[model samples]
Target: PSRTEGNTRLYTDEDLQRLEFILNLARDLGVNISGIAIILQMRERMEEMQRQIHDFVQYIQEEVLSRATAATDASRGAIVPVRRPMVTPASQNTRKK
Candidate 1:
């Protein structure tokens, strides 16, 4: 609910939708006012958590892409030599009794 210039409460489309949701919870779902409040609070918290997760994912993606680009550019003219370790074969002789 918002206040107007005449000190009257104004309901927007979003407000109406929320009111409808609350009414549905009370009438159809047989939820009490306190239960409805709890449900709404939980819903808001979940939505906030979801938003944070989305932001974190976006940040990680950007960081990864930036690091990859920097690594590619830094290695453009560099020569990295690869070496493999030599392994010796085990002797097949067994101890005699």
Candidate 2:
């Protein structure tokens, strides 16, 4: 519930959703008010942690892309030779009969 200019209580969609969840918890799950509050708090914390993780991953991706672009630009027009591992044929003694 929020206070209007006239000091009347105004419930937003989020408020209504929270009220519904609380009602469901009490009626369906038989959870007490304290338990409901604790569950809500934990849910909020978990959501926040998830958001932080997503943001961190995005940051890492951006950093990696920027570094790769910088490296490509710096190495432009450079012919870098690729070296392959040398393979030697096995001797008759080492070969299976």
Model 1 C-alpha lDDT per residue in residues 1-97, reported as the tens digit of each score: 9899999999999999999999999999999999999999999999999999999999999999999999999999899898888897656664332
Specify the poorest-scoring 10-residue window by lDDT in model 2.
Answer: 88-97
**What ranges in model 2 sit over 4 Å off?**
79-97
Clashing pairs in model 2, backbone N/Cα/C closer than 3 A: none
Model 2 whole-model lDDT (C-alpha atoms): 0.95
Q: Could you give candidate 2's per-residue lDDT for residues 44-95 as a string of tens digits?
A: 9999999999999999999999999999999999998999999998999887
Alpha-carbon RMSD of each model: 8.3, 7.6
Q: For model 1, what is the error of residue 42's alpha carbon versus the real structure, in angstroms, after optimal superposition?
A: 0.7
Clashing pairs in 1: none
Q: What would the TM-score be for candidate 1 when compared with the true structure?
A: 0.75
Candidates in order have lDDT scores of: 0.95, 0.95
